[model samples]
Target: MKKILAVLAVGMISSMAHAATVGSQSYKDNIEVGGSMWIPFGPHADSAGLPGVGVKGVALGQLSKISMRSVRKLTEQNPDYGATDGNNVTVVTPPAHGKVAMGNFNFAQLADSNAEVYYGEWTAHNDTAGATRSVYYVGKDKTANMPTSGTATYAVKGINQYSGNNQLNGTFTADFGKNTLKGSLANNALNVGVDAKINTAAASFNGSATAAGKTGTSQGHFFGNNAGSLAGFAKFDDRKLDTAFGGVKK
Candidate 1:
């Protein structure tokens, strides 16, 4: 019993040491192919590995705090680095357009990795047409000290590749007791519903999504000090668009 307690105490200390907090925004990018969106940055964003080929380097930025507001007359930008991925609750920040918006998404990745993963939605005001909408993050996965029971609700944001890379926002609920997640995203245009089962041991999840008569598969991982955030990708059956989303514990 003493040995077991010692091991458990060590594990707890390690997790608290790597707890999530505000850190530098290292890099952010997204991709569109044949009208579908995909993440171009991640823990291996700078690796020579295939599939995404990784990025040369990350564009650093500082996170700010603001409030939630709807973006007006915005178009999706193919590639821009002038936005912050902010959750629509708690902390908020104003975008380049001078509009107030929620913006607090900083978390720690798994200790074995040097990458960070941030998830939230943002609009870039660097475009002439107006601005571009996107979902982004800057860390990897860290799911230590996660709650073993109870439920957590999150405010989610993402990019819809089919809708010209438009912004998608909604809420997601994670049930730690049942190890499940359910979420929905919609605007004045369309709605998307997602469901997934959580693997508590792996700190990951996979499931299905439905939207406008189309079905898709969704997969993502949990992050933060106590599994306070999540981010993932969804690919539809029609191959029309891809959705990437993330959120913070609300």
Candidate 2:
């Protein structure tokens, strides 16, 4: 009787494992797409205490929205083990007729189990003041992970106002399972023809982040000749997870 009982226990365990696998697959199959939206506050306030003039606070005078989306496919091994083959990112700011709008398109390929390579292009249009302007950017990002941690390198070029600026490069590295991301950008040249050497600079940010449930902060510095000497600090808190779903109507 003891031997028969052991055999029955083994069968029950196998049945439970199969049930769990099926449930997990179903969850992955139903996950269509997801993204996030961040609303900036006091850090964006103007020195005059008037809001929205600078990057310190939200510009209620204007409407801006940013979003990201991914198209992922499930793998046979594990429904979640599949890949994200494409992504679309968009930023829209209103006062539509005279405002600026931007969009970025990204295509990604899973080169291996833990590595992905992506190519993206960005375009921005502004019809503000008496000036009508546009800019275009193209870039690539390569990310990889192995025995230890992971790293990514991104490089992009911008063409604006009929002038060419060759470089905006960034590098990021992270330890396995850590919420912290350490990264830096260098030799960034902005506003090429107008400022020439004025916007040439180097900047770095090293911060720890606790996501969704924990508060976190990071501080960094930037130095450049064109922007005429500026420095500041940044922080994050009250992080939470939220969801939204919508689709275009026929």
Candidate 3:
């Protein structure tokens, strides 16, 4: 029985290795790509004409290409290395240029909680050889331990605007921020092609989303009608994923 079990384990390992070999190759190719939201936003975009128009400041860093042909493989060797343990993800790097010359926050996203599941922070190589930058949500609402209904919040998670629930009606920007989602940039990116356009930019923001289990309004603040100021949840829904999020600033 022990020998049989050992053989079975070996077989499983071999199978995984085979799959990993094949999957890694394809995954590397598929994963080594500039995400749809890989624009030059964040602080670098500058808070100048933001919420208005024009350059939206000017993206500090734009991940033009990601070469996953050779990546850091700590997860493969150590089980507890990365949080995801997928061992498929690789560090992302910017090509030649597209990075703004200003304040830091370079690979800030990598250190954020979101990077645990999504890609880790994308450290930049501005000053040194590697800096980090994870994400700049056009919109995402993350609460502290998922608060009850009607709690004022800030901070978004990702770029997925249009988050809906029973009570909450997050009317996202609807334009995907006009930069990556509505301009020549997104229309000409890798993986995310022109067809990847988010045609339905939410026109109406939803306020008051109830918890999936709770019958009463899910307990959260509804960014109601407020002109000139953003009002809506972008990254999450009602199941505690909802919170006050400022999707796109520029």
As for lDDT, the candidate ahead, 1 or 3, is 1
Across 151-231, the per-residue lDDT of candidate 1 in tens digits comes to 999887765532334567799999999989998987666687889999887777789988787887777777766887777
Record all residue pairs in model 2 with backbone atoms less than 3 Å apart, i.e. clashing: 43-56, 44-56, 44-57, 45-56, 198-226
Q: In candidate 2, what are the lDDT values of residues 1-250, reduced to their tens digit? A: 7975564344334323321111000011111111111222222211110100011122321121111212121122223322232222222222343322221112222122221111222222333221212121111111111212332222222111111232223333333224233433323432211000111122222344322344344332211221111111112332111110011101
Worst-scoring 10-residue span by lDDT in model 2: 241-250
Report lDDT per candidate: 0.47, 0.21, 0.21
Where is model 3 poorest over a 10-residue stretch in terms of lDDT? 18-27
Ranking by TM-score: 1, 2, 3
Stretches > 4 Å off in candidate 3: 1-76, 79-81, 85-120, 124-197, 200-250
lDDT of 3 by residue, 1-250 (tens): 7975564344334322321011000012111222122112322121111111111122212222211111222222333322222222232233344233211221111123221112112222353432122222111122212212221222222221111111111222223233112111111111111111221123223222322232211111111121112222211222223222222222
